[model samples]
Each structure stands twice: as structure tokens, then as C-alpha cells.
Target: MSEAPALPPVRRVGQRSTLAYGFGAAAYGVKDFGFSTFLLLFYNQVLGLPAAQVGFAIMCALILDAFIDPLIGFLSDNTRSRWGRRHPWMYAAALPIAAGWLLLWNPPELSQDAMLVWVFATSVLVRTAISAYEVPSQALTPELSADYDERTRLTAYRYLFGWAGGMVTLFVTYTWLMAGPDGQPDQLNRANYAGFALFGAAAMLLAIFTSAIGTHGEIKRLPRPEIVTKPLGTHFRELWATIRNRAFLILMLAGLCYYSAQGISFALATYLYVHVWQFDTAAFGTLALSLFLGVSGAFVIAPRVANRVGKPVAAMVFMFSAAALLATPYALRLAGLFPAPGDRVMLPLLLTLFAFNTGCGVSATMLGASMMADVVEDSEAKTGRRSEGVFFSGAFFIQKCCSGLGIFAASLILHFAGFPKGAKPGTVGVEAIDRLTLYFILAYLALGWAAALIYRFFPFGRDEHAARVAALAKGEAG
Candidate 1:
């Protein structure tokens, strides 16, 4: 093969490019909101499937879809095209993802077995389509800039927009689309979900295309990998070698635990609010605002914290703090120390603490993503290959497990707690609610703390990353 062309040195990405990159995450956010918040309820409460069946279908779908991420990542890494390595896959994914999302929400009337099949199939389609875009899109972070702090800043914007998109969708769903007739808590109403499906599909399509077009200008400036002709087995071996770094493995493990906790928290959010806390539609809208505030705060908090304490330490602190904050209200309520569900101060107090918890949690997530980007250069310095796609695909794989393992775990909690189906808020028995709260608190704390402690084992920091980048640059110049 001919010698590969040299690329320009990595510099600070422009504001416009950064914003466009961040905006792309809105698609993933929208998808996440739908899956975590409504999918279980929609199937179990509205469509009349059993909760175990619904949760199992979702878990199966996510697990099945996760296997596709690495393949998409590998293909994108070696793709040669006029539009570049990432854009073709990104553009190809838009329509299919939107179509699959629409289908997922609009399943036809069928038997219980057939309905389960529909859920599994549509869930897999949507998740796979999302991977086709998200893996390549996330890989761009390393290609766009090499500075440690800049990567954290870029990741902050990504998380900010991602969370904002979900929160905005949540606000709209509660305030208008899912509002019960005559102020009734009719989240179980079927018609409301139809509106949600349409809105989510349109938003996802727009975000994906906008991001692809917006970042198209960066193709010329980004590095292009040499197209290698090798046996398929040989390619897999190289991929394994590139992704087997100690830092990458630790980050992946940490993400597995962290995202699982997130999955469980998000999956059970509706049940907790509607049944345990007895929040009304108006309160749900307010909750959205609070979450949005927290994620926005994270955009500022993560970068500053990373700059001061280094990404690994900052991530550990925030993760441990977030876990404690998140579980406090549940623990206090169970112990009869916090405000009762109907007290005037309950909503305001809970929302305040939730906002703080979200800020810290999201800060930790942003720092972790930045840390993954740093691993790209560290791997490249040792292996002579840039495997952004492989590494980010590993990250996405862990995220999918969050949906699978986490949601499945949530279903078990519900089953073991004996949570009744189709029960209205404020009507569930005290024993069931107590069991639910206790199980959630225990599981959440265990997973969150485990993820945070795993970060302490990661091998390098800012200085090591800088040294790796310098070494790679020297190799290129030679």
C-alpha cells in the first residue's frame, strides 16, 4: 500500500463545530427518554402485557442490539468515502431510526405472545439504528481535539444537550401529550402515547440530520486511517489488541456499573413518582425543569472540576456524592424523617435535592467520557492504530447493558416487592411501596459506589495523556 497522507496537528475545535457535535447527542437523548420513561408503562399498563414480559422483551432487545455496535464501529473506522469515515453511517441511520421508533410505539393489536415479539423486534431495530449513528459520532471527539481539558469541555456540551433534549421532551409529554383528561393522572391513556411517538420520531430525525450536515465541514481537517487489506480474523485480532488497554478496561467496567444504575433509576422513575411520591402532572413538568437545571449546571461543573482535580479524581468524588444524594430522600422517607408524600414542602424539597444529585451524577458521566477519549492517544502511542470507533463502541456496549441488566433488575425488584399493576397513585399498599423504596435504595447505592470506586484503579491522568500525545506526534513527524 502507498504511504498514508499526513494530517494537520490537532487544534482547538471551533465553537460552531463543537456545538454541532453536541447537538447530535439530542437524538440519543430522545430515544433514551422514550425507552426509560414510557416503554414499560406503555406495554404493561396500557397494552396489557405483564410487567415481567415487558421488561424481559426490552432487555432481550437491548442485548441483541448491543452486539451490532462493535461491527458498526469497526466498519466506520476503516470506511473510505468522499463524505468521510463517519458521515455516511450517520446519514444512513437517520430515516431507519425514525421509522423504527415510530413502529415501536404503534404496535398492532395482537396476542400476548405476538405482542412480546413486536416489542422485541422493534426495540432491536431502533437500538441497532441508533448504534449505526452514535458510535461513529462519538468517535469524533478524539479526532476533533487532543487537549485533555478540551475533551472534557466537549463532553460537557454533549451531555448538556443530551440531557436537555430528554428533559424538554419530558416537559412536553407531561404538560400536553400525556395530560389526563380533566386533570386525571391518565399517563396510562393510550392516545397520549401516540402523540409522544410522533413527536419523538420527528425530533430524532431532525437532530440526526442536522448534526451530520453541521459537522460535514470537519472531514478535511480530521485524520484519515490507512485502508488495510487483511484477513477478517486478523482484523479482529488487531481490534482486540487496540481495545485491551488497562485504562479502557477499567473505564468500561465503571461504565457498566454506572449506566446500569442509571438504567434502573430511569426505568423506575415513573412508577416511583406516580405510585410512591404520588406526583401529579404539574409536578412531573416541574421535575423536568429541575432535571434540566441540573444537567445544565453539569456543563459548567464538570469541566471546572476536571481542570482542578483531574478527571479521574473528580469523577470519583462526584459519583460517590451523587449516589449518596440520590438515595437520601428515599432512605429518609422510609425512616419517617422526611416530609410525607402530600406535604406542601415535599415537592420543592425533593426537586432541589434531585437537581443537585443530577448535577453531580452528570458531571461524573462527562468526565468519564473525556477519559475515554484520552485513551485513544494512549492506545495509539503503543499500538500504532487509532481505534476510536472500537473504544467508543465498547462504551456504547456498556450503555446498552445498562438498558438490559438494569431494566431487568428493576423488573425483579418490582416483582419481589409485589407491586400491583394498573393501581392508581395514592392507592397502593404501604407495604409494597416500602419494599420498592428499600430495594431501590439498596441496589442504587451498591452499583453507584461500585462504579465510583472502580475509577480509582484507572492508570493514568492528564500528564500521562499529554506525554502520549507528544509521543504520537513525534512518531508522525519521523
Candidate 2:
């Protein structure tokens, strides 16, 4: 087996470069905002498809795209190009992502079955296109810096911008595009989605191009793997061996659980806001601001916390904290100890809890991703290969699959709650809303706790990662 050639030492990435790299995640954030926050509502309420069918179509798309992520990752890893391995794929994905984003929200009138097929196909296209960029783009994290704290900081930037992009778009959608003439939110108006879709497509295109171009200068500084003549089976064997690292597997399990909880929260956000909370346009905008502020707080909090405790411990702490806070509002409401849905105090209270919840949750996620970057060195030390693409893609693969399940679970929640189709805000029965809140609280807490506990099983810390990095450096020096 050929080891990867040593190319460059880890250096502190410059602010410009870090910002560029981080901004690229906005493209993905835009895609996520559409899929997680709006897709179900648009299809179910605006287009008149059933919630279960929308969820099924999206789940299928996500699962299919999950399989495609590894291929993109593998191809990007092995590709030899003057522009370097990752950027070409990132550049190639921009236009398709834009087109797919447009098509996904602009489906023409069709029978329910045909619409389902359209939803499935467009969703697959969008997800695959985004994966082409994201898998490779994220794979850049480990290559850019191998330092423990630096990776955490970089990951924080990525999450901050990702959340900012999504939240900004969301804020704009609720306050402007989706608002009625009377200044209330009118999300069920099909015409409102056209502007949202266009804005998202444009944002995605700009983000992809900006990041690919912005980071283009680092091509020569990144690692250059040795060209080896390996047969198809050998490559697959190596890929499998690399991903089978114990730490990587543990992180994947944690990600599966964490992202599942996130998916449920995101998929049901609009439902909870509109039906249960009766939030108006102003309230939605404020919620988006709160979420953005939370993630920004995470940008400051994650690395500091990870530096104090180990990444795994910090992640577990944040995960557990986030879960408890997330469940608090629902539990309070269910217990009849919370503000009424339309109470003046309800919005502020919810926003405050959500801000803290997002801060903790995003911190946990940042630490986990940084942990994955650390895994690259650990795997390279053990296997004589640096498989950043494979590792990150594997992480994303788990996230997409599990999050898909979460979305499906959300649909089930709605179905079982007997949430009526086309029901306006404030009209959903108290019983159904209560049922929805209970189911969400239960699932969210269960998954959150499971993920936090699973994080404890991660076998390495900063010291282990440092040792692996030094070992790899020594081997290369020899």
C-alpha cells in the first residue's frame, strides 16, 4: 500500500481564506433551508399533496443522495488536476444546484402521483448536486489544518455561516416573500414560493462560486496524494478500511442520532410555529434572528468549550444541554405551565430558550465535525492513507440517512396527531397540537440523549489526535 505523499505542514489559515471556505457552506444552508423548512409545507399545503407522500418522496431522495455522496467523495479524492482535487467538483456543482433549486420549488400542475415523481426527481437532483460540492468541500477541512483547536475554530466558522445563511433566508422569506399584503405571514400562498425559490437559487450559485474561487489560491498548499495504479476492488477495500476506524464509526453513530433530532426539529418547525405557537410574520423573523444569534454564539463558544474539555466531552455536554432546553418549551406547554400560544410573553420566552438551544446544539455539531477532521490523522497513522473525503462523506452519509428518517418520523407525527390539511394557523385543535408537541418532545429528547451518550464512546481526545499527527509527521520526515 502506498502512503500519501507529504506536501505541506499545517499552518494557521488566514482570515480571508477561512471566511471564503466558511461562506461556501451558505450554499448548502440555502438548500437545507428549502428542504427542511419549506418543502413539506409547500407540497402539502400549497400544492395539495399529502404530508406523508411529501415526506416519502423527500426521504427517498435523501437516501439515494446519501449513496451518491461517497462516490463524489471518492472521485474527488482520487482526481488529479492542476486546479487540485476538490475545487473542480465544487465548481462543477454550482449550476446544477441552481437549476435544481429552481425546479424543486416550481413544479407545474400535475396529478398527485406525477407530482410525487417530480418531487422525488427534483429532490434527488438538488441533493446530488449539493453533495457534489459539499462532500468535497467539507473534505477540505482536514487538509486545510491538522491542528486540534484550529479545526474546531474552522468548524465553528463553517457552522456559523451555514446557519446564518439559512436563517437569513428564512427571515427574509417570512418577513417579505411569504408575507401577505396585510403584513401577516401567508405561507400557504403558492405564489409566495416563487420569489423564495429564485432568491435561494441565486444565493446557492453565488456561494458555490465564491467559495471555489476564494479558496482557489490554496491549491498548491494542500496535500497531494501519490498516484497509484490500484484496481477497482483495492480502492474499495482501502476506502472501507479507512472508514472503519473506531473513532470514525463512533462519530458517525453520534452524527446519525444528532442529525436525526435536528431533522425532526427542522421539518416540523413551520408546523410548530404556525399551528401550535401562532407566530406572525414578525415573530417568525424574530425567531430567525434568534437562531442566527445562537449559532453565532456557538462560533465563539464551541472552540473555547472544546479547548477546556475534550471535544467529545464538550460535545456530549452541549448535546445533552441542547436536548433538555429544546424539550423544555414543549414540556411546559403540555404541562400547562407555559404562556398561551398568543400570549405577548410567549414569543420572547420561546426565542430566549431557542437561542440557547441553538447555541448548544450548534456547538455540539461543530465539535463533532472537528472530531471527524481529527479522525483523518488517526486513520492515516493506522492505514497509511489520508482519507478526508471518505471520512467526511461517510459522516454526511449517516447524517442524510438518519435525518431522512427524522423527517419521515415527523410526517408520522402529523399523521398520528390528525393534523388537518389546509388548516390555518390558530385553527388546529388543542388536542392535535398537544399530541404533536408530545410526540416531538419525546423523539427530540430520546434522540438527543442517545447521541450525547454515544459521543462518550469516542475513543480519542486532543492528546490522541496530537500524537497521531506527530506520528504521521515523523513518518513523513523519515
Candidate 3:
């Protein structure tokens, strides 16, 4: 009874413009590391909260994030705005994140219980506001370009920028935030307030400006669809169908496992390096530098590797390689062979494993983003609607929810393993350290294998995506 809107032309997005959006996408990771990497340490070390209480606080905040993300996606999809659905929210999130980052870092004078409440409440508000922007920001990708190779390029660029942001945060946090003025490493130092707050604020502003400038003409204003104006129930039903799509479902599962391992591993890093390896706080920077380089190198090389071998094969190979390498630390430690506590053996181990796993991680990032785009096309084919918001919402759901689960798991595991907050030395036992190391190794192995299996079920690799694009050219949605 209603005419379907004419399909928008698949524009060729150039490297510069795409990279700009990628920078914006990556800037979000600044906030990510802010929360995941430093927040627990902040509460436990600076605020004097215990490990169990810190873990409990994080879980509560994550639960809030889990419930709010989908609702934000649903609202963002239906929003009618002249500045565009995503950008308006993107700009709005900047201030809240800045304020929240400041608040999380410098809590007002309050009891530990009151401090927990403040952190939990503000974290929920900050992350929720961020999702409001991020879900829609990602939704813009499919709308920006539909070419198969173009999507991969965009992902690569974004991954690089995101990795850059993460690395910057890591260096500053580990080096300056935790160091005393005498250039000595002091785990208790919090005077690096200027450095942390400045970067967070800078990233937030840079992202807003980049999104506004980079995507000015890239995103064409489409006539608002009557179908999109339907009731909330209609949107929920459509979102349900999108979730049920097999390719998306599998990817979501894989993301949950892979990021869970990643999250847990990151949370455990300060402890592992200090107590287990007996390295100073500065070693965290060295290890992070190696990890960042490894992952960065992988992102750079992934496009060519995916082009030569199939994306799935490349992804599978890298995933397994990462799993093997991640275990090297544990293997060496268990064998009573690690460098003495202060010898920086962890640096060499990190470098070796990171070299291989970095490439693997790069391949995974490329494959994962492209896979989601393909699924979006496939869903459009079946449903006869261009629902990029819903599509990316599902993608965001998988990625964030899984990473949140990972962080959640890490919090619980650390508490159970007796890993004390602030590395309150000798409070946690050697038994706990052994168990934690084993947990890290086994968890990464399972996550890597599970992600590979999910890729197997996803039929939208390079060739398939090309075919799908060709079909779209011939006036068929599939």
C-alpha cells in the first residue's frame, strides 16, 4: 500500500573522511580505559574501598549500563533531529563524560559507603549518556558507505585511532598518574589529576568537533520514513527480529567471550606485574606499550592478510595464536622460570606474545566490523527496511555487553582470588596468585576458540559480502 523509498547511492568514502569518523569512534575508547583500567584502582587505592566492595560497585554499575544501552538505542533510532540522530547525542555526551571522569577521579569527602554510591550513580549516568551517542555514532557507518572494502578500511582506521587512544591513556596513567614528582613510581600517587582530567576532556571535545566536521556532507539527509514513526512496540519487535538473525547472534556470543577474557586480563594486570612478577608500576607502561604496538601492527596488516587469505581463516588463525601466546606468562610463571620479581621478565613475555596476538587482534577487529555490516545487509534483505540504527544497536549490544561481562567477571574473580585492592602487599596469598594466573590463561583460551567458532557460523565473509553488494545494485535488498 506504500511505496518503498529509493535506495541511497553507495558513496565512495575517501581515506581522510573515513579516518576522521574512525578517530571519533576510537575517541570513545578514552572513556573506556578511564572506567575499566583506572576506576577500580582509584576506588580501592585512593578512596580506601576494599576489593570486595569495589567489585560489587562495578557489577552494579555494569547492570545499570546493560539495562540502559538498549533503551538508548531504541530512542536514538526514533529521534527526529535536524543535526542528525547520532551527532546531537554525540555532542551531548561530551560534557557528562568530562564531569563524570572528573568526579570518578576526585570524589568529594565522604565515607567509603557514600563514595561507592557516588561512583555507582555517576558511572551509570556517564556510561548511559555515552551509549546514547555511541550506538547512533556506529549506526552511521552503514549509512556512510556500503562498499565491502570501504567498510573494512573504515574499521581499520577506527581500530588504529581507538588503539592510539587506549595507548595514550595507558602511558599517561601508568607513567604519570602513578608516579611521584621525583619520577619514582608510587602506586599511591594521585596528583596526576591534571594529566588524566585534561586528556579526558580533550578527547571528548575532539570527538565532537571531528564528528561535526568529518561527516558534514558524508551523511545525506533521508526523508523520514513513516515506518520508523511507528509505535515503540513496533520498534521492539523489529529489534527482536534483528537479534534473532543467526549471524548476529553468533558474533554476539563470540564478543561476550572474547572481551570477557580481555576485560578480566586487563583488570588483573597491575597485580600480576607487581606481586607475581615483582616489577615496579612503570613496568605496566612497558608491557602496555608492547601490547599496543602488537595490536596496532595487526590492524595495519589485517586488510592485506584478509584479502590474501579469507577473513574467516585469517581470523581463526589469529584468534588461536593469541590464545597460545596469552598463556605464555602463566606457563613461564608456573614452571618457576619467570624473571625475578624486579627483573622485568614480564616485558619480554608481553613483547613476544603481543607480537603475535597483536596481529591476531587486528585481524579480529577488521573481520568483526565487516561481519556486522554484512549481517546488517542480510537483515535488510529479509525485512525490506534499512534499519542501520537497529543493526548497529545489536552490534553495540554484543560488544559492550560482553566487555561489561568481562569486567564484571574480573571484579568477581579478583575478589575470590584474594587479590587485595591497592596491592596492599602480603594481604593476598600466593595460592590466590596461582589461581588468578591459571584463570587468565584458561579464560583467554576458551574465549579465543569460542570466537573462532562463531566466525564459522557467520556466512558473510569477503566474497559473500561482495555478492551481497552486487545483489543490492540490481535492485534486490539481499
TM-score of each candidate structure, all chains considered together: 0.97, 0.97, 0.90
Q: Compose the digit string of candidate 1's lDDT tens values, residues 196-283.
A: 9999999988888888998988887777877779999999898888878989999999998889999999888999988878888889
- Candidate 1: lDDT over CA atoms? 0.88
Regions more than 4 Å wrong, model 3 = 1-8, 181-184, 193-195, 221-228, 341-346, 424-429
lDDT score for candidate 3 against the true structure: 0.69
Clashes of 3: 3
Lowest-scoring 10 consecutive residues by lDDT in candidate 3? 1-10
Tens-place lDDT digits, model 2, residues 1-478? 2333463366789999999999999988888888887888889888889999889888988767656988888888888888888999999999999999899999998999999999999988888888899999999898888888888878888998899889989988999989988667998999888899999999989988999999998877788878698999999899888878999999988888889999999989989988878888888889998999899899998898788888999999999999999999999998889998778899899999999999999999889999999888888878887788888888877766765677788888999999998888777889999999999999999999999999998898988777777777888521
RMSD of each: 2.0, 2.3, 3.3
Model 1 Cα RMSD, Å? 2.0
Q: Is candidate 2 or candidate 3 better by lDDT?
A: 2
| lDDT values for all models | 0.88, 0.87, 0.69
